[model samples]
Target: MGIRSVLSKPLAKWVVERQREWMYRPAEAQQRWMQRLIKGGQNTVFGRDHRLTDVRTVEEFRQAVPVRDYEDLKPYIEQILNGDSDVLWKGKPLYLAKTSGTTSGTKYIPITRDSIPNHIDSARDALLNYIHETGNGAFLDGKLIFLSGSPELDQKAGIHVGRLSGIANHHVPGYLRTNQLPSYETNVIDDWETKLERIIDETIDQPMSLISGIPPWVQMYFDRIQERTGKKIKDVFPDFSVFVYGGVNFEPYRAKLFDSIGKRIDSIETYPASEGFIAFQDSQTEEGLLMLLDSGIFFEFIAADEYFSDNPRRLTIDEVELNKNYAVIINNNAGLWGYSIGDTVKFVSRDPYRLLVTGRIKHFISAFGEHVIGEEVEKALTDAMSKHPETEVVEFTVAPMVSPAEGLPYHEWLVEFATPPHNPAQFARDVDTRLTQLNVYYDDLITGSILQPLRLTSLPRGAFQQYMKSLGKLGGQNKVPRLSNDRKIADGLMGVVSGK
Candidate 1:
């Protein structure tokens, strides 16, 4: 074995042991971090304005600061952008993570010096945890490719500004730099198609062992590889054992991805955002991700059902219950106060606070009071596909068709199929049945005849990709929403179909 492979076991063991110190003591670690954040904020403008210095408990902190989205916090962000120090955090932000915003256009999230480790180390810890559990560190000796945004960055107001993936490129540890694939020149290409082609050319001949990206984009890479070499990914890169992915749930794409690889390998799911690295899969046997309690972010939850209600109860870590969906609110060391990143999660195990990302607060279908979520739609489709083993899905989205040319309005499933189902009508009915079982409100609406049974629209290949390209969000952290209450996406898909 190589020196790095031999040493990985001991290093992973040490990291796992240190992690246990904070992982098991959830309440204590959260309380301590909350106090530290409060103390750090006391000297900043945001802290003084919100009376944070006098806050001694989580309750006081909550009372002092209201939960705010990007729009609500823009004034403070504007001040920071104009070269002001101590406006939000204690000092100027180390970097600004630029991400796409639905209503706000582009959002610049502060990455303070104190908060960078949370983003960097959590990813490292996730890999180490996998090694410690499986005793398979040989992948460390081979090439690893992270299919992400360009590493090149621009400066705004003296702070480096770029996508989170790009900013993270500057912090990759020295030890693994040699094994990381795609030369810097290839990484800086702005056009995703060009970048993808370059990446395939660079890595196809290498002894690749690990690959990481959002599922759809990674699927595209795999597809291109097969097209070029007429071989499955496993044949081209036999040592490719670990697949690390994040940004979206992998269930819907799992069957197709595995089929593309032609074998089953270890995969890690991560819950990361521009705001923070919240959770990661710690155990191969576990169903949910282990939430990071001491990652410089103090978390609060509001029940998903009550999220739209006035005076929603924001509960701390100790107050959360298992299997109940709650919108996540975070107060982190990066100067974000009571920030809502729009994700909802459900705890599966409270012993170590492992949770599943249920859905986004705004990404849902409640057109007829049938409030269907991402989790429900994904699970419904997954269950239905289980029976149709020959069918393979490429991409899909759900939107309400309130005013169809014929019949009662219904939920429309726009799917791009790699292999069409043998009985498409039966497949749609199966999916509808599963969805109705998962969501009582949806079931009621269907039974009462308020809405017709859901309809399936088989989209032509690359239809969703064309829609994303039309919106100038073709790649790099952009994902199709699982479902939307409005028909914007449905109409857009129609446009793409007609244009084709």
Candidate 2:
């Protein structure tokens, strides 16, 4: 037997046992989790203010703490930043994960000492579950590469502040440290291009068995690796068996990644955010991720349609249904209470709870009342890509053109193509047709001539790269928002493309 086979047997058994417990007693698990989270933070300012100590039931907890967006929770975060202790959690946070903000400039999300172990354990379990399900423990025998953010962190009021991935790098177990690729020196490099080059140099000849990263950066790495070696990735790393991805939907990048590898490779998707490691793909036979019921995060779901209502319904694990989109609300050990992470998800299974991330709550186009979301646009693009097997989307974003003087307002797509379709206009038409089929309001608008057909703007090569560079968010978990309600991002993209 291989070294991995011996070493992973215990881990595999543990994962299987925990998974069984979660499957058989999901409701009980969630209830116990809720109690733990509330009791753990009850001594903190936030918990006391929300009457967590007196609250024993989920309903009482819900009634006490209202769902809050980033704006609502800013004051508490400011208190934490100003060197306050026991503000949110029982103790001070170990790190503040700095993330790119939407309306605000930058957000410093708390990462408490208690929450760090949960993040590490949950991430480990995601891979362990894959190994248990697939009986592919030999992957652990070889090196693994994690395309993460720079590990170099900044200190803010005695708390380390950096990207989540960077913070995660520091907590990698000592056992796995030797097996991880791209030495610590390479991982600390901030510039993506330089970092990628150094990673390629370090890992090109290693016994690479696994790779993990967000799809775009991973794709870039694969391209460069293939370019340098003049061989398929599979050839470069003969032992490569799996490619793990998270943070973005894999459908758009799936075909290209496997094609570059030159064979089918197992892939696991995860729904991990800076706030918490929420869900992970546990079963290859299943369609969606199995919700981690005991992972130190308490989840509540609000139906997307009801989210903006005066009094939206809050649904727990027991109440959620299959195939319904929900805005995810989380209360975790990190001391965030009823915080809306702004991502939307749809349950694919109820027993043991599996879900697919649908889209970002704020990332959508509602101009002319069509109400198109990231899911619809991504699906539309996927369908369009399906019709043209030769084409590949390197990067893309969609936005609305409102009140155009010359023509009826239409949705604008700025796409940077790695491989252009034989018929670009046909591809655009296919996208529009797919959108009309998926969204009733969009169909009505098109039928009634209230909006013109979507305008396709084929961006010159490297347009997205230039735009990202301009924004100073060139790589490492930074991605182009798929859809924008207004033309600002699209206009910025056009200006970069045209160099005007």
- Shift in Å, residue 322, candidate 2: 1.3
TM-score of 1: 0.99
Tell me each candidate's RMSD, in Å, in order. Answer: 0.9, 1.3
Q: Best candidate, TM-score-wise?
A: 1
Residue by residue across 27-62, what tens digits does model 2's lDDT show?
Answer: 888898899988898989898788888999989999
> Which residue pairs of candidate 1 clash?
none
The global C-alpha lDDT for each of the candidates, from Candidate 1 onward, is 0.92, 0.89
Residue 160, model 2, lDDT: 96
**Candidate 1, 430-486: lDDT as tens digits:** 999999999999999999998999899999988988898888777777899999889
lDDT of 1 at 220: 91
Instruction: Return the lDDT, model 1, position 142.
Output: 94
Predicted structure with the largest lDDT when compared to the true one? 1
Q: Please list the residue runs of candidate 1 whose C-alpha ends up more than 4 Å from where it truly belongs after superposition.
A: none
